[model samples]
Target: MSDRSYRFTHAITRKPAASIIAGLRAVDTGTPDLALMQAHHAAYIAALRATGATVIELDALDAYPDSVFVEDTALCLPSGAVTMRPGAPSRLGEAAEMAPHLEALYADVKRISGPDSFIEAGDILMTETEILVGRSARTNAAGIAELAALVAPWGETVREVHTPPGVLHFKTDCSLLDAETILATRRLSATGCFTGYRLIDVAEGEEAAANTIRFNDVVLMPAGFPRTRDALLAAGYDLREIGNSECAKLDGGMSCLSLRFTSKP
Candidate 1:
């Protein structure tokens, strides 16, 4: 088996700060309280670092408010980092903004082009043998095919999983906690998605728990999901609860806030 531990790279936003989607959409929306958002981001970073993994913080983007979610526009893989084509038009600039930073961190970088295809980082998950990609409104068949070709030589098979239309992102509804197990809400199974994989059910009130992040044997979950957290603890996993109040406002869960990478040695 391959031996590698997960690492994290995160960016803190300053302007047009993280806010609730409903608040952002409001006609007279006010600025998001930055102090609270920063505190939450700091706590999350600390928790990940506690796992004995590397933690790199991207310098704050003073100009772009939405740049905090660096994971949505690019994915870090064993081969290199892949710049994505965000499905949301409002988020298109994110890819371009992430290119320079990724280029500095990685020796090689690949991209998914526009007009013909699109792919989002959150729609992609990496396993030891293959890369599982989700085909959703944001990610197309052409994009998945191109990504597959890029990683094929590395002996990685790109499995395309279909996503239901209304879900915001694939990872939002279903998160690959590890190579063998996945945490998903009932909504995902109702659509007959993710064939061949074992699904761990998250209760109705604990649906948000499906968004937990797993690094090694430690799972970082959001606060207030005691039942789900307890279940995970009972399963012999260490659980850490962090407050994600600002992220929840934008329909983001623990998984969306950051992209994790496991380095194979």
Candidate 2:
């Protein structure tokens, strides 16, 4: 196995109204108002680097305005990387843009074709024993089956989790905070979603704040969500709250800001 730590490379792009479902009618719809998005992406990249992980920055794909969020369309593992066929037609270009980077990162890079199969990176959560994939509109049954076959040889089990129909994606409602624990929203559990893993509840109205990224002992979370942040801090986690107001306006939170990976031992 490779000794090098997993590194992340991402492109920061301008947010478009089409990318954000809630802000489609706003005046700043198509403008190049990427300043805040860029800053948040940069901050996430910086935080990942602080974990002593190698960081690679890919050139922006001018064709796709939302290409900066590399996680939405691909899954990278030490053995190889899988390029997903985004369920959203508007985000299809992200898979094409991510292929070259994956090819360079690992000797074996595979792709899941659409028209029959569709998978989004946000639906995949990796743990030491298995790869939990969320089955949602963005990630279909075929996609999960294909992914399971692709990673089986690597000794990784692919478990399927049912997602709430109303949720936009899985990561937004549920995320793995560590190997043993998950920070999940009630919106997800109450809907009978997340079939396979253990669910740890966040307080009412604290669902959005449940989305967190674990970097070693430190957890990166959104600012202004003090209830959840304080809960995590009191639990012995070194919580780092970052401002993501602008990104939130575009339907983005901490997880949407960047794609993170760790090399296998």
Candidate 3:
């Protein structure tokens, strides 16, 4: 296994369902156009492949409206994957649907089974040394404790961070740019969730810009946030921009679309 937690060699994604319009929407971005969403998804997948991680494409479940946001289903760590129990009732089935895929990829797959535990991978950020868990409406303290216990054997630690008010997920406001850096909105940074890492603030009014995913060598970010794009590039990182106009309408973005990981020996 590699030493870095974010160096992924594989990725998993599911297509958006026709019922995606029924998916959770915290903001009024309008209904997503399915055809346009697919095109964006294609571009997102292309970017993931460009990172040199083999993409494991899964079929869309017409039953789960938010299945396309696969990252909510599990946490991919260096030791193994922890199949999650999503806090959103509508999204609960997603973890079970994604478990087999994770089991096929990792040797030691663990699961969060507490009847009251509920967490989503999007709310959990795996930094180089610790797991920064966002305590939000979508993730309960029980879930965080369960997750911490599940990965304790791997020498991975978990720390709880307060999510900023009015965000759907913690990742909706911040993301790990590299081992020692975080791309965050000023609002989130003000909360003091990130203490030791260098904060690269996104352009004012581009708070969503901090949600990009750092793949192997290239970070995949949403297009149209030009000022934020410039900021990311100026910080000395390679990038691949993908248009997520449709997905954005339903509270989705680059990191929401895929579950990236590396297999164990």
In candidate 2, the residue pairs with backbone N, CA or C atoms under 3 Å apart (3 or more residues apart, or in different chains) clash, namely 6-263, 9-56
Model 1's number of clashes is: 1
TM-score for model 3? 0.97
lDDT per residue (tens digit) for residues 1-265 in model 3: 4436568888899988999988888888788889999999999898888777899889989999999999999998887889999988998998999999888778889999999999998898888888899988899899999999999999889999888878888999988888888999999999888988899999999877889988888888999899999988888989898998888887887889998887655
Q: Write the residue-wise lDDT of candidate 1 on 177-240 in tens digits.
A: 6666677888876766656666777777777677777766678888887777777777666788
Q: Is candidate 2 or candidate 3 better by TM-score?
A: 3
Per residue, candidate 2 scores C-alpha lDDT tens digits across 23-115 of 311134343346665666677767766766566776665566566556777777767778888887778877887787667657888888747
Leading candidate by lDDT: 3
Query: Where is model 3 more than 4 Å wrong at Cα?
Result: 1-3
Candidates sorted by lDDT, best first:
3, 1, 2
TM-score of 2: 0.83
TM-score of each: 0.84, 0.83, 0.97
Q: Candidate 3: deviation at residue 239, Å?
A: 1.3
Residue pairs with backbone overlap in model 3: none
Candidate 2 global CA lDDT score = 0.67
Could you say which candidate leads in TM-score? 3
